[model samples]
Target: MTDEAELLQRLWNREKNSIDEAIQIYTPYLSTVLYYMAGNSLPKEDIEEIVADVFIVLWKNAGRIDSVRFTIFL
Candidate 1:
């Protein structure tokens, strides 16, 4: 598997550093997703906040989420 996929699997397994890895890896993608979801109607700051909220949700639900393929699942 790809290195990212391996790291995601580790995160899913509850490795402490995995959360940091996920945030670093997915922030840009999440921002893009939020931007499109908002229809670009929100200000940059608001969009960034929304993206942060999405990561919070992911962290809160880490155990229940299948992090191995979370980017696709999200």
Candidate 2:
């Protein structure tokens, strides 16, 4: 696993590769959470969309994120 602080720094720097790293590191967890939260109301594709949207939002707000206190999802 990549160091969280390094990932955060790379993200804040707007490094494209860091988005891929973050997706790889966080996708499974996010998918599972979305699955439970949706509770059968949403289709698989919708859950997937939500997960993707999360990364998009994160990337958009990367510069505003605080590495030292980073806790957006875990």
Candidate 3:
């Protein structure tokens, strides 16, 4: 399986550092998406907050997640 798949598994297991890895990988993508979704009008802090909340949600729901499903969900 792909590295991202492994990461998703780790997230499901609540392995330490998995969320950090996920944040590193997805934060930029999330930020850019949020920017465009908000018409690029949101302040940087607001974008950051939204991105953080996304990760937190992922962590909370990781047990039911898989990379394929998550990529589609994202």
Candidate 4:
């Protein structure tokens, strides 16, 4: 499997760094999504909070998530 695939598997298994890797790889895209979703009305602090919430959701749901699937889902 590819590195990202391995990372995804690790994330599914609850490995600590897996979420970090995912965040590093996907934050820019996720930020853009959050920004757009908020209609650009959010301040920097609010945007940061929303991004944190996104990562928290990802961590909470990691077992059921496929990173590749989420790449598309995002």
Candidate 5:
């Protein structure tokens, strides 16, 4: 299976490490996107807060997430 697939599966199973893996994999991408979307107005700390909120939402909804629809979470 693809790495993302495996990660999603682990997330669905509530594996603690899966969240770490996800943050490692996605944080840079999300941070960049958020930074750009924020138009450089928000502080780094605000961007970090938004990113954390995103991960929290992802974790809360992991069980209902479709493995094939992983991109939806992002």
Candidate 6:
């Protein structure tokens, strides 16, 4: 498997470091996307809270999410 695919699996399994890995890899990207999704109308603090909420949900649901090939997280 690709390194990222393995990392994703680790996330699904709740490996201790997996969320940190995700933060390292995905936070910047997701934050940028969410900024655009919010039309840049929200304040930075609100955006940050939204981002945290999203990750929390991902953490909660990771194990139950169906993946075609470990290619989907949201």
Candidate 3, residues 1-74: lDDT per residue as tens digits?
67877898899899979999999999999988888899758899999999999999988998888667766653
Residue 15, model 2, lDDT = 97
Instruction: Give lDDT: candidate 2, residue 38.
Output: 81
- Alpha-carbon shift of residue 4 in model 3 (angstroms): 1.2
Off by over 4 Å in 6: 72-74
- What clash count goes with each model? 0, 0, 0, 0, 0, 0
TM-score-better candidate, 1 vs 6: 6
Which ranking of candidates, highest lDDT first? 2, 5, 3, 4, 6, 1
Order of quality (TM-score):
5, 2, 3, 6, 4, 1
Model 1 segments more than 4 A misplaced: 67-74
- RMSD to truth, every model: 3.3, 2.7, 2.7, 3.1, 2.5, 2.6
**lDDT scores in order:** 0.76, 0.91, 0.87, 0.82, 0.91, 0.78
* Candidate 4 global lDDT: 0.82
What digit string (tens of lDDT, one per residue) describes model 4 on residues 1-74?
66767877888999998899888988888788878888758887888887888889989987996667755543
Q: State every prediction's TM-score relative to the real structure.
A: 0.69, 0.88, 0.83, 0.73, 0.89, 0.79
* lDDT tens readout by residue for model 1, 1-74: 67766776776677888888888888899888878888858999998887788777767776785654566643
TM-score of 6: 0.79
Off by over 4 Å in 3: 67-74
**Residue 24 error, candidate 5, Å:** 0.9
Q: Could you tell which candidate, 2 or 6, scores higher by TM-score?
A: 2
Write one digit per residue (lDDT tens) for candidate 2, span 1-74: 33887899999999999999999999999999999888999999999999999999999999998876665545
Candidate that scores best on TM-score: 5
Worst-scoring 10-residue span by lDDT in model 6? 65-74
lDDT by residue (tens digit), candidate 6, 1-74: 66777876887888978877877788888889888998869988888888788778888888975555556543
Model 3 quality (TM-score): 0.83
Query: How much is the lDDT of residue 4 in candidate 2?
Result: 85
